[model samples]
Target: MAYTSLYRRYRPDTFRDVIGQEHIVRTLVNQIKSGNIGHAYLFTGTRGTGKTSVAKIFSRAVNCLHPVDGSPCGKCEVCLELALSGNFDILEIDAASNNSVDQIRELTDKINFPPTIGRYKVYIVDEVHMLSKSAHNALLKTLEEPPEHAIFILATTEVHAIPATILSRCLRFDFRLVPTSAIAARIRFIFDEIGVEYEEQAVNMIAAAGQGSVRDALSIADMCVSFCAGNVTYDGVMEVLGTSDPVKLVGFVGNILSGNVDEALKTVAEMCDSGKSMAILASDVAALLRNAIYVKTCETAAEILSLPEEQCAALRALGEKHSVQKMLSVLKTMTATEGEFRYSTQHRILFESAVISAATEAPAAGTTAKERELEQKIAQLERKVQALAKPGFKSAPAKEDAVQVWARVASELQKKGAAFIALAATEAEVESDGGVFRVKVGSSSCMKILTDKSNRDLLNEAFSSVCGQKLVIEEVKKLDEDKSLPYITSMFGKYLEIK
Candidate 1:
């Protein structure tokens, strides 16, 4: 016998064998049992979620001499013959390859004929969305009104590509990706039946790496089976996936947040030395950061994030020390570098830069607790400052109109020594507090320059000079702008020059 891939070997021969698509299976099985089979059926889903497998099973069941509870009984004459002689009456067409009008015309010409052995002639069209407009038009009429003996099962990963008219003619079944636990259970079943030794974490790793695709998981499991030569472990599977251990991801995140740049870079080097793809490692780190954000902010983190128990617990424990704001800051850094990592071959440099951005945004590691408290205080104040920048902003009687306040402060900033600061804070705004002045600069870069006590004091004297009142300098923050790409570009260029 020739070698068969795990996906094909483990293909669901019956409705009960298919996993994670209970809704679709139940409806189809019920339809078959009640003899309410439709002429045209559309199965839509991501790959490896049992759309094609269910289609095959349904084709067999509807033609079985005696189906048991809407499932095909393999021992029957019709089932035996159809199983032995492939494509007897079951014409499996790859629409991706044969998606031309002539092929569709050929298909339509034969649909009127009756099955040779089974009760129904089934035509399974895989990737039916690949059909051209003319081809779709040719098949539309036949699909909408196929002969009693003919049944069309159209399967496509991209269902939106199919026309609305074709969609309307068929009973559509959407298949969801199988959950990790279910995929792991199936892997365990496969390993047990094959008499292979494997660790539970190894199975989970494979399933998680599959991203909810059972076929993809099984394919990975098959590779692991060959690579490990029977005994499979998490590390072994991680190597195969070109991903660093999730533990490393957790450690890398901890190091980044704690501002331990040397330790974080060491971890990246270790992964690279071990022949791991920085792209995959970056992706893994990003996922853990996102999970950390969810764990820190959401009360139902476990419900929302599909992670192992111990991992989720560890994340939550680590997350308690961090703020939701900080996590989002790091997440933004990760997202910023994600596309760059894909295109640039300087993976190490990009990874380091992203880590630096994430770290620099965080409070200093020495006095983290106190700094976080102060940062949160500033964050709250910044929100008020933002509101003040908006049009029609109102404040207490002592507080001047925000626009007038900004105009006075900006003019004060443009003096001799603070000229550079004034240029950057062109659109700076101010808020009054009896004697304290809160100046919200145009952006963080501006804050970096103008927040120097000397510069701010100079501005304070000028604010007093302009507004004719003694005022103390207090706070600073970036102005909020929904359109700020030019600022990002300018700031990024400055960072490149500085670094």
Candidate 2:
């Protein structure tokens, strides 16, 4: 006989065996005990959350001749009869393949027929949201008012795709994502039953890789079991899931938080060379950073993170050495980069760039003394610039020529916070005639800045202070079409040299 997969081999057979869905289980068990089962029920949630599993269990319990606490005894005549593959009392339908209007009509046509062996004829339609509009309309009336002997259980992962009309007619039960701890416990039980040797951390890793899906988790566990040759280990699990080691990930995050770009990139290069995917690496790093933040801020982080004590200690050490803000910034960068991987082919480059960016933005504690020194020098320069812009600064003598007078005015403007205007005016030509000053600038941007009211007022005040009299300011244009010389030389050719 062929080997059965772990998920199928360990599928929940009864409501009692279902994990991580107590709310729905309690309600269904009560309904089964009270005989108040609804005609139509809708089970919705993410895959592997026990919607279909619960539906099958409930179907069996309802038809069981002897139900113990709302669960099928599995030994009664009705239970035995319904357990057969050929039984007509409980039917499982894959709505994905049989989603046409005719298929739905055929199902509705048989609803009036009473159960052959059980009290209710249960129809379990998995992925019911895939049904066509006409098919949904065809089954609407039958679902809304099925005969007393007929029951409908519609299971779907995407509940929003289900029409509101159909949704309103059915009793809805939402299944949540199974917790990692619950999944880990279940894996441990399954491994014990099968006599599979595994490390505790390895089992937890497998459970987390499942991402709250029992089937997905079990599928990964199956691979791990086979790959490890019956002795599952943490390294084996990491290899199977394509994730990094938690200790290495913690160290990688440490490099980032401490602004060690070289070490961080070296780790990334090593992972890439070993055939690890950049996208998965980014996700792992992000999850580790998030956990570190929880350890830093949350009081009960040990309980919340669900990681092993050793791993938590490492994260706690990392969190204690770094601020929450720096970790959050790195986490944000990594998450944003993960989204971009879908659109680009250069995954390694993008990942490396994000790592370098995060490391570069690390807090002051991460900066080198030389970098801090440079930052201080920059601050000093800014203060000097601000100081030079103060009032009461003297200018050139009043006896200076128009060129010298204009140079003095430009220097004063540079000191008074009009640096751009002062720089642009350096290339312009100035002339003084009858106590009127005319200026000509080549570039339109420079002209606009020079013509501004604030800049114009600065220019006028500088001229008044330098030339000992207020001069009328006028902007002029060049009429001589000489393109050989530069703008400055063309305007100030006789006064200046080409050099």
Candidate 3:
């Protein structure tokens, strides 16, 4: 016998064998049992979620001379006849290749003909969204009023592309992604039937790599069966997936979370030397961090993750040692690197940079960690001052000097939670002119902050509180000569004589 791929060989032939779409199955089963089948049906979902498979099964069930619980009895004459490859009752159309108006017209023209061996002539159109606009228009009329003996089943991954007219006329059933646990169990059953020796962790790993697609998971299992020569191990599955060993990944991420840049880089170099793709490495590291977070927070982490006991224990231990924020930060960096890899040729360099950035707690552009720390400290001090300077307290006497009054205004601004404005005010020169406070700032950045409407309002309120009277505040640009040596010497007088 010729060889067959695992996915194709294990494809579900009946509704009972389908997984992870019980809602759709139940409704369809009830429809079949109640003899309430619709003329037009739409099955929509991601690829490998069994939309097409279920469509085929539903077609057979409707035409079956004997249906056992809404599924076709394969032994019946109608079911056996429809099972043939050349069955005239069931027609499978690939809209991707025949997506023309003429093709759709031809299909519609054939709608008048009844089924050769069954009650309904079922038309299964895969990738129906690929049809052009005119093709959709051509099919719309027939779909709206098809013959009683005709059943139309349209399957598409992108249902948004389908016309609303077609959607409104059809009974739409959304197929959901199969759960990881269900896929894992299916893999175990297949492995046992195929006589393949495997580790439980290996099955879970393959199922997870499927990302909720049964066909994708089985395809991966096929590759694993071939590569492992009938014995699938966890490490073998990791190699097939181009992912790092769980132990090594745990250690590598541990180094990163602990801010050990040197050790983390060494681990990266080692993985690169082993021929691991940098993109996959980043993805695997991110997945590990996400799993660790789940393990730490979720009560049903082991069940949700579907990880083996040993790996779960290791992840639990790792999660206990690191904070979720730190892990999420690193995971964000890794995810960004994965996206950047598509645009850059230097994957290794990008991955290493991300690792270093995550490890070192890289500050924002043009700002050092020390500067951020100082800003934070200033904010804390401002909060403490505001808490101490509550209402109903006696106000301090108004100062006479312009500089002293400006200092009091700045203090008042800090109490009002304008710390940045207060800091900028320290670098500005203030003067009293006609009972108005004139502020002169040399730096354009400082001027920008003081001139903002909200900040200006804050300054006005602060000046009123400090000066014991409401005053109009005006922003003024300092003269160039104000920075000259002569001007400075005159302002300082004999207290600071020029050399």
Each prediction's RMSD over C-alphas, in Å, is: 19.2, 26.3, 24.3
Error of 1 at 129 (Å): 0.7
State in Å the error of residue 343, model 3: 9.1
lDDT of each: 0.69, 0.75, 0.75
Model 2: per-residue Cα lDDT over 26-96, one tens digit each: 99999999999898999998788888889989999998988999999999999988889867778777665
Better of 1 and 3 by lDDT: 3
**TM-score, model 2 to reference:** 0.66
Per residue, candidate 1 scores C-alpha lDDT tens digits across 1-499 of 8878888888988888888899998998899889999999999887888888898899999999899879999989988988974445787776655324344344443555678889898888888765555456656766655778888899987665677899999889988767778888899999998888999999988876665678988999999999999999887897787666777678788888877888988987887897777766666676677677666555555543456666787798768776656766786677557546646889988888888778877473543678667656644443333333332222221233334455545545653556675554443455654444555543344565666778766766766665543553332321122212222222112212110
Better of 1 and 2 by TM-score: 1
Best by TM-score: 1
- Model 3 lDDT per residue over 1-499, tens place: 9889998889888889999999999999999999998999999987888999999999999999889999998989999898888776787776665324333334443556677898998989888776555456555766766779988899987665677899999999988767778899999999999999999989988987776778888999999999999999998898787667888889999999888999999999998998988987887887788678777766666654556567789998987777666776898788667657877999899999999999998423443577457545644543343333311111111111355466667777877889889877766655554445666664555777887888988887888777653354444432233233332232112333233
* Clash count, one per candidate: 0, 0, 0
TM-scores, one per candidate: 0.68, 0.66, 0.65
